[model samples]
Target chain A: MQKDSQKTKLRPGQLSRPKNLNLFTIRLPINALVSILHRATGCVLFLILPVILLLLQFSLSSAQHYETVIAILHSPFIKLMLLGLAWAFFHHFFAGIRHLAMDVHWMTTLMKARYTSKVVLVLGVLATLVLAVKIWM
Target chain B: MLIELLTKRYPGMRAWLTQRLSALVMAVYSVFAVARFLIVQPNSYEAWVDFFQPLWWRIATLLFWISLCIHAWLGIRDVFKDYVPNPSVRDVLDKLLVVSLWVYLVWATWLLLG
Candidate 1:
């Protein structure tokens, strides 16, 4: 009776810390990671808007400015950033579609949802690669 | 009856449907645009102009721009709806956002192809 009373008073044990900081962490599920990525990508795109606008402004200013913008884009740092942007854009784009599909009652099953998310990630990588190769070559 | 009830609770069925449809369109358009930009890769000003000079390519670019505008509108609308509680304020902001997005899209398209 005393032990039972103590159990009630003590409550549950503290949860263990997450296993890893990497993608394989036990605490962060795939859906949660994707959700976080969606928000992160959205913010990244928001930030990129001004950069995009600057490029457009430069490109439209004159032939000289256009050449300058082209030169800037060809820089290694800019290339890396563009690659990241491409990946994020594709990821957000596909994940948004998946979310919309879920809203409409398509691919809502647990198994299907997992599969769809995986497919979207794979497709995003493939699309990014295609873009990368085209840009680099 | 259940569907009707649910739709009523959500409201804006048309908005939701159009948003999803636009997103799907944009997804496909993005893939193609990325591929096109990569493959032809107009490395020079004349090459870029040549790529843009094609009538069909211009049309495709126009469609992609439209898709992007629509997708962004839908996505931002959701964000505003979620964050803004007052209906009047949300409505005004939503309208403003849509207008601004259209303006930006028009401007960008003109600069790119013009």
Candidate 2:
């Protein structure tokens, strides 16, 4: 985010390089990609958490509400949505830990940042996989 | 222009620290809740209700709710602060967000108690 302007700035003679500004076509650095995913996941979790809480509340409130909630949970579509929520939670959790590490002056170097970003992404996905199994299997 | 506005207006290091601390709280609570789920097999409605009936668990959950609201506010506000450059609009939006979070927390407390 800090060097966003620097990224768009064109250097003299550097115009010879591909000016591919398309996000889909151009290659992005792994760390940059991780950063984008982190933000995206955060946004999803931010929007989804209230719904999750409401569902939990329903599950606990009354016998009828609990039955209805459990029936909804048994649906495959709801299961899929639950998996998505779990992935969002895991991604946000791992990427948040990475941010905390960066705050501590570690993983600030280019090499370390890239390596850590990869680790965060992998761990996030792994945690989600475990959750998916727990829910689906 | 929107990006620039969004990229600015962060409440700085204090908010950053708060987010981190609240995240820690939530993560720890997740572990505790998951472990209880595994051990107790709280699959039934009565079981789930019983699980949440304890005073200590209720207190821990209340703590988690507080942390969650704070974490959510700091996280969401971080993004909003960056994009909403107009102080008046930002302030209104921020207050609304906080109020909603607080309202949820109160609702959660009632759910736990009632």
Candidate 3:
């Protein structure tokens, strides 16, 4: 049959289809960028769980320990690291909310999704900026 | 139809719903926590201790941690499934993830209630 011949021809074409895996060569759309960042930030937040717990325990143990924890957090390098982690949290928070909204049939269109993606990114940065000011000013 | 999707017949749907539900819990908690912190402004050791002293607050915190563990487990499992193609390696990673999440859950429970 003609359909059988077409199927036979398609097999070789599919097998020879070009594959690109180089990450740098592939430009991600805004939604994709937000989506991947959400996952990356989630991993970051999960990995830091132990550190957060340790710091909370240390800060709660005694007055002196609390002071020491405060001092450590206030150090310049640690403050920078904290700001980075805060950004991660903020990004994950906003992007996760956007995803939830989409799940409930809100902003399901491509253009609106892209707009929400930018909103999430900007809100994440804006939140970190506010926290930076709170920390340093 | 919704109940059927969440039943044992459709495990992927169950997992999807769990992830979303856990996310909702955590999101609400995060907002509440920030607002509470701003209002309390726990500036001293005593104040900080007091911030956590309330029994209800501690219970809420525990619930947040539980949601967090569930959320993390599902998220990391999906990450492993996507990136780790080798079945054996993925299995090991999956076990590791489960073990670590349990340890965290235990630690959090002890911290909050112990």
Best prediction by TM-score: 3
lDDT of each: 0.76, 0.82, 0.95
Tens digit of per-residue lDDT, candidate 2, span A7-40: 8675644443445677788788999888878777
**Could you tell me which residue pairs clash in candidate 2?**
B5-B82, B5-B83, B6-B82, B6-B83
Name the DockQ score for candidate 2: 0.49
- What's the DockQ for every one of the candidates? 0.31, 0.49, 0.85
Query: Can you tell me which runs of candidate 2 are displaced by over 4 Å?
Result: A1-22, B1-11, B85-89
- Better by DockQ, candidate 3 or 2: 3
Comparing 2 and 3 on TM-score, the stronger one = 3
Assess the local accuracy of residue B30 in candidate 3 as a C-alpha lDDT between 0 and 100. 99
> Candidate 3 chain A: minimum summed lDDT over ten consecutive residues — where?
A10-19
* lDDT (Cα) of model 2: 0.82
Off by over 4 Å in 1: A1-28, A60-62, A100-106, A125-137, B1-11, B85-96, B112-114
Error in Å for residue A19 of model 2 = 8.9
Clashes per candidate (backbone, < 3 Å)? 0, 4, 0
Instruction: Kindly list the per-residue Cα lDDT of model 1 for residues B3-110, writing each as its tens digit.
Output: 674465666765666666776776777678767877998777777667667778777767766776776777677777778999999999989877777787877677
- Supply candidate 2's per-residue lDDT for B19: 79
Question: TM-score, chain B only, every model?
Answer: 0.74, 0.80, 0.98
Tens digits of per-residue lDDT for model 3 on B1-114?
999999999999999999999999999999999999999999999999999999999999999999999999999999999999999999999999999899999998998899
